[model samples]
Target: MDRLHSDPGLLVCPDFTNECYCASCVPFISATITKEQAAESLCLVWVATNDDLCIQWCHQLAEETCISAKQAQAAAAAEATHLHQVHQLEEEMAKADKQKKNRFKHTNILMCPCPDTNEEEAFVSDFVLQKIDKGHFIEFYYWTNIGLEEALFSYSTRDDEGLIPSEQDGATVWISAVASKPSKQVVPDRFLSPVDFAQAVPRVVAALKEHDWPNQWVLMLARFWVAIMTHQYWNSNDQIAQQALMIYQEEQQRAWHNAVVLGNGAWDLSIISNTVLGRLFDHVLCES
Candidate 1:
């Protein structure tokens, strides 16, 4: 572990020293790395986690989002606050009976699709939104009840070292469901809409054209959709709701900044928004 993470063998113990070192462990350390530099073995997985555009945005955010370094510190502080609250809640939930817990992990996002939110039975998405935003770290735009949507804003079962990213939980886990069937029609409940799902496609294709991601787009997109689709099950508003649309737009801007830095100017905002993204959406939807 020391050799892998560049830490002291037996002299000093860093705060993140609890990571596993077994050979059977999957290379999840590279999960935090960008698609451009990760090994090819993680290619399909890299996409399953995040395609090119999102990875580029995350990397660019490390630098471009910083203005005089103080804002960067603030972002870290914000993330830390979010993580701390999530940890506290996770500890609380893990103590509960197995049938009534949730293992909120990873950094997947969704946005609002419902029109109204004040009514009690308006739509489950609004309920999820409300629940998640109520957390100390989450600043969402809806009202909530259950702690389900609060998963991301609170930060419970995420950031485990040497752990593979997926919807499944390995150890003591928590699964949740929300009802979304309106008049027997499976509509966009508390998660992203079908159109919104297609919105991220151009970003992926552009990432493939400009930078080689560590994974295949097909598997990644499939897994991504599956995760979102999970929100359609059951009825629980006390959980995590969808994320804000502004966050994704910010993601696209960061990708543009990364393209400039890497000299991959062939992929640009106008191109992705107009030609690439529109066409990519058509391509993926046609296959679906």
Candidate 2:
């Protein structure tokens, strides 16, 4: 035992020193080592005592260290990818916010149909009239609770020799109202008269109150209705008017189905009664 301790080669092996010290057979070393340290040192001791066990211990330690390194690398990579995605989402949100601010700064024109003259007329706020110039095209956006809707109009001087005969030489603006449905279908041009619009106010207000819609929402809906009314007057020969009439008929049918067959509320019924179909139905009933 003394000869083994005296040997420099044997003393260099930590596993042997740990075993001898723990057994109270050696007093050369006072400091204690951990189990892992002892096990790692066992590889060197095994090389002298048992070669097979030494090879196995060395291989196991190498594999465990390699696995730990790979796991740390994978964790670091995952954290970086997550940070990159968060940055991209923030950038997209900022860009959308900037676009929304720019769009809201412009004023829109509303066009409505006259029930007495059977013609379409454009309505612009005093502020818009002051700012708008001839030959300038204006684009306006309407918020419909569900999504954004856009309309366009261009200002031009009317010539008496042009398609529509005008008594006075004045500036005329042609406006188009485009309704963007949830299904993304573009329904262009609808009409409303001043008398109808006046009558509609109370009914729309009542319906909105009954349905518990916000007061601001009523204003938005009113603006949308006025925008649709600004197109060409109802003429069977006009292709655009005809298309608008077709879409109106389809919408009325769908509303009727929802109300009568699908058990929708009075709000849907009110919508049906307020449109052209309601007037036509009343006329038919009066004739009969």
Candidate 3:
């Protein structure tokens, strides 16, 4: 990255399929080249779009990485072992199934940071989580304006019938997931823009850096195509932004119902925000 950026024409074809694919053309490709690097290469692709050389590296990396049948079976077995407590195997058809609703009291919901940073608040409300009681498990992505990737929060009670907080008027107290961990020092509540987000990233990163995860984690990633920036630009009054917020609240209401059926009292989740969604803050400067 350093060399390529220093001389804008330099390109490197990595052997990694996800990074770039056509290293065979590297000699003619005319950019600096590396056979294999570290995971940091993938990190760059995740954060920033890839340049020409990087695309070639990613294609090669993806084309070569395949699992053997033996390895695949072993992996399947391991997943079953880990999920045995929550899921049951019906060997007849060889399908995995959740234990009967009467058999299990609660199911756990996992969440994590959204890669886009723009839809941090929207990740929860916009994606809206729900337990089986209300409906099926759904996955989604949304836009948020924050950049910090380490902030985490979750509820702890799983047995309460009405514990999960939705957008409804009355709800239980929701807590920060990683408050026990160290993180930022925001003195007060205010709408933050990209500039303010830069100031807050360090603190948020500090709070979530401690844990090694296999736990339930959710990531909602939106790209330049998402509406996150619009909330801050076109809808400066927040009336429009509030529509997204309402979407979140309704999702919350649904989550509350699902959590009741899933028997997860403390394990439910909620969004705790000091700022409302609007075009008045950080998104304006960055929105394309």
Candidate 4:
């Protein structure tokens, strides 16, 4: 057991080996192979030779991965169905916005640091701000320092069914900032442009640092801000962009539901925020 624990890689079959095929057929016969290792070997075996032995080994691996073969089948079916639904959504979005090609395409300048800062600080430029706010963009200023419970109380109200409404405005611009600043400190109702918002980033970072917020939290906030900036730019008249925004909002709503309604309330803002940035990054920035 100690040897297996220390060198789990030993149990993993080397690529294109006879042992890889044999181990999948008789998993228990191999004392060195763990369940995970056996399952992986089975996959490789099946990919190489789709024979009766491979079929049996496939079932065996599925059983080992999930609680039961039935559950595994169900999970596989569910994933297939979800993928089909996503395909349908994409098609519908494409057809609906056939006349709106390249509507979401824009230059993103917020991802990098300001060139004038000697590479010391990141700042948003007027060009980016104008681009992101080109249409009917709604600005959102969220306090990053507050707890999840506090955030829920401040931002949303629950219905009788205890569900937060999913109908968030698509054009909303979410900007994370420190909310506990002094009363005398003047904060804007809306950031006029990217240049205006860029100036606020350093102050928020400084406050977060001084208050001893977790380094992870600070980093997450920064990343999320970038994601939000990306989101604002993408949430344009383009059909794909609109569809992506819809999907993003659904994810955010689900996250809020899980956190507040499901009582798993914790600092899980990253889950949804990261999704926004990741899904939109390539679509908005990379495509020609």
Q: Which structure among the candidates has the greatest lDDT?
A: 4
Query: Residue-wise lDDT of candidate 2 within 1-288, one digit each (tens)?
Result: 111212233233445545544543233222685554555555455556545445555666677789999999999999999999899999988876876688555323223232222111222222223222221111121111111211112112212213422222376543221211112322221333233343333333333434445544455544545443443333345444434443453455345434544555424322323457445545544554
Candidate 1 residue lDDT tens string, 232-263: 32123422222322223334545544564576
Model 3, 80-174: lDDT tens digits are: 89788455544522332333343334433222223333434323321122221123332221112332232223222323323323332355544
Per-model TM against the reference: 0.17, 0.26, 0.19, 0.25
RMSD of each: 34.0, 18.8, 30.5, 27.6
What range of 10 consecutive residues in model 1 has the weakest lDDT sum?
Answer: 135-144
Worst 10 residues of 3 by lDDT: 217-226
By lDDT, the candidates rank as 4, 2, 1, 3
- Where is the poorest 10-residue window by lDDT in model 2? 141-150
For model 3, the superposed segments whose C-alpha errors exceed 4 Å read 1-194, 198-209, 213-218, 221-288
**Whole-model lDDT for model 1 versus the true structure?**
0.36
Q: Identify the superior model by lDDT, candidate 1 or candidate 2.
A: 2
How are the candidates ranked when ordered by TM-score, highest leading? 2, 4, 3, 1
Cα lDDT of model 4 overall?
0.44
**TM-score of model 2 vs. true structure:** 0.26
Error at 219, model 2, angstroms: 23
